[model samples]
Target: MSATTDASRGKLIIPVLGRLYSSLHDAGETVLRVVAGAFLTIHGSQKISNPFGAAEMVEGLGFYPGALWSLVLACTEFFGGIFIAIGLLTRPAAFAGLFVLLVTVWFHWVTMSQGFSGAEKSLLWAAILLFFVIRGGNRHSVDARIGKAF
Candidate 1:
């Protein structure tokens, strides 16, 4: 359709897909948020259970006070994931997660010398967290229910 026609339909370029998107975009975003948060939580569960299991690894990465940094990392992943999943304090939680993802990106790209191939996943995760850090949560989130965000 012409640009004017599409615009009149409340779509910019593609009215058919745009209408579909308008209907389900929020649900898609919610699913993305929940799934990403759940994956992060799962990734941290083992570390959180042990609490300091990553001490040596963190120390190797030059995070002084290995045990402390390990615990912090664990909490940042585990609890931050929970918060993000529930949409409670989403921006802060996502910001924390973004930091962790950025560290992983650095580790994979620089520390391991793995380059883009190895760092790609971390980069993607970082991007996702960065989105939440900027966008906070949606209407389906706890933040919305409680009438607060950030």
Candidate 2:
């Protein structure tokens, strides 16, 4: 091919690669959202189903009014996870997950002084949540569907 043709081909390739990368990123975000939502939902179910256990953990964490915080966290996890799964209010749900992870890191993980060990999972999830906040959900999301209908 001529030099000009080669350069034109290269330019076309860039956009194709960009589109592929964007699609992959969106798929990964969707997976992350679903997995994180499911995990949080299960954990929250445990807490809400057994309030005493949650209260004890809250007390151990030295949160004032342990029962209240436990209840709030439980609700946040349960409802937030559902919202995230459906991609309804995705930004808010992601933010809620990020907030929960921040609190978990500050209250539970920081005390150990062992960086990214026990808290690594939460930190990873927090990063994923932040990503969702920035990118929003995929086209499969309720938000996108609703947006198109209006």
Candidate 3:
């Protein structure tokens, strides 16, 4: 009937729900970090094998010194992914990843005219990176261990 009646029956619904929610929230962030980090690392592996392989693509995107941009892209995705995975400089890494994903979003949307079909995954990844940019990898990260995150 009332809150007290429920407590007397040994059922504290609010406290139970609160604890469950907190646990799930923390665990969910860990899972998100792992998935985003591992996947990005894997995706970058091909380009990393030949850092300049994407030069033509970068040139086509109108970035000067195609080789340089290509190298930047390769390292950002590969190393940034690792940083994000370890929660080391998580915000910066996620921000860089966000930049890369945003470029892909624009490329897919405007250059290719593929819209959601081509950009959906990149958009999702960008959103996740954006989250990390704001949250800084949470308490489960290296940022937390070494010091309080910025």
lDDT of 2 at 18: 50
Worst 10 residues of 3 by lDDT: 1-10
Model 1 per-residue lDDT tens digits across residues 70-124: 9999999999998999899999999999998999999999999999999999999
- 130, model 3: CA deviation in Å? 0.3
Q: In model 2, what is the error at residue 113, expressed in angstroms? A: 3.7
| Whole-model lDDT, model 1 | 0.90
Clashing pairs in 1: none
Write model 3 residue lDDT over 6-43, tens digit each, in one string.
46446554655655654577788988997899889999
**What is the TM-score of candidate 3?**
0.87
Give lDDT per model, in order.
0.90, 0.75, 0.89
Candidate ranking under lDDT, highest first, comes to 1, 3, 2
Local lDDT at 60 for model 1:
95
Which candidate should be chosen as best, given TM-score against the real structure? 1
In candidate 1, stretches whose alpha carbon ends up further than 4 angstroms from where it belongs are 1-14
Candidate 2 vs. true structure, TM-score? 0.73
Any idea how many clashes model 3 has?
0
